[model samples]
Target: MKYEGKIVLVTGARRGVGRLLAEHFLNQGAQVIGFSRHEDDEAQLPGYTPLAVDVGDPESVARGFEQVRKQFGRVDIVINNAAVLTSQYAMIMPAGAAKGMLDANILGTFLVSREAAKLMRKSKWGRIINIGSMAASLEPMGDSIYAATKAAIATLANVMAKEFAALNITCNTLGITAIETDMLGQLPKDKIDAVIAGLPLPRYATAEDIFNVVDFFASERSGYVTAQTVFLGGVN
Candidate 1:
């Protein structure tokens, strides 16, 4: 119960990595709040609340935070896990697809982190962890927009680390490798296999692997750590 009494907010928590993260935090004794475009039955779980929040929209995000303030009074840790990915060659990528990726991956992280920092300031301690991707460093073919958005995630966290330092809030990025998620399932199996084969570990990452890193970043002992990006599978 290291996170006992902590209020954790996870974006895109309807499914996939976001949902897994919400569960993990709850098990650690946190009061978990999940933000998704739509809520689900899992919202009924003890210690977890799901809110409909489109992080890409400023107003929607603001309303979500308002609800959080009213219900939890504050946010202590935030995992910016909301993102949209499309793997397509730069030449053939649709404009709307690129824009959607930018909005969900980049703008979403920015808006959530900004609001999280504000709520955290009350207690003068917080953790903002952005879910990045190995694609950023790999720069895989046909992943121009997706990779760029991920790379931007790391950059955004780094800058926020400095900006939020005075508030005792640390910001960092966790660049995960391929995992069994609906999003990853959208990619070609052959492509994912090829990429994993080239990795130092050469295997699919597990939910435990992700949660381990998250725990480290959210640890009170890690207050001195900020502006860092840790990539799984030794990508960087």
Candidate 2:
């Protein structure tokens, strides 16, 4: 769909993949609202509003949406991209890290999607696209909590799709493979390389690769597409 007049919200918009998505939509003429836990210093572009929000916190999410409601009144698309990933064996993972993943990866997506849906229902047409991970289906070792959270998001989207069908809001997930982002930089290079080598498409996903799928999900033509998880690099 044309983003010329669409109102788009993207979580985790301070950096990496989320920032990329936000900027792309903004360039397409959408009025973009970006949520980041960090201060809103990076995005000063026209038609872009950066908000400080911790998606896992109910109050923060609520306040962020309130700002959007006052400023834009409705949302046309939402990208649930805020997440925390800890790649340690479950036995060795700290409780704090596990809880962080649960809060940010699962709870964050849940909060943002629901809040965005509220704004969307006003318009009676909306797209809720979740940013998921290959870890969800790959189930690699050393990512038990992280993987579980990603998997949970896909399931969350599935049920939401059913509930929101009549409202014209379609929910879906894009479980992307590794990309050269800060998130991937946190992992062990050798291990990541080995994992990529095993994939049918053994390469890092590019920005365009991600945009293609996101655009698909955000398209008006995809009204019938909901409750689906599309994984990249043949991971699914």
- Report the C-alpha lDDT of model 2 over 1-236, residue by residue, as the tens digit: 26998999999999999999999998888999999998889678999999999998989989988998898999999999999988998789999999998999898899888988887887799999999999999999999999999999999999999989999999999999999999888899999999999999999899999999999999989999999999999998
How displaced is residue 49 in candidate 1, in Å?
A: 0.5
Across 1-236, the per-residue lDDT of candidate 1 in tens digits comes to 89999999999999999989999999889999999997677578899999999999999999999999999889999999999998999999999999999999999999999999889999999999999999999999999999999999999999999999999999999999998999999999998999999999999999999999999999999999999999999899
Stretches off by above 4 angstroms in model 2 are none
Candidate 1 off by > 4 Å: none
Backbone clashes under 3 angstroms, per model? 0, 0
Could you tell me the lDDT of residue 1 within candidate 1? 89
Per-model TM-score on C-alpha atoms: 0.99, 0.98
Error (Å) of candidate 1 at residue 175 is 0.3
Which candidate achieves the best lDDT against the true structure?
1
User: Model 2: how far is 140 from its true place, Å?
Assistant: 0.9
Residue pairs that clash (backbone atoms under 3 angstroms), model 2: none
TM-score of 1: 0.99
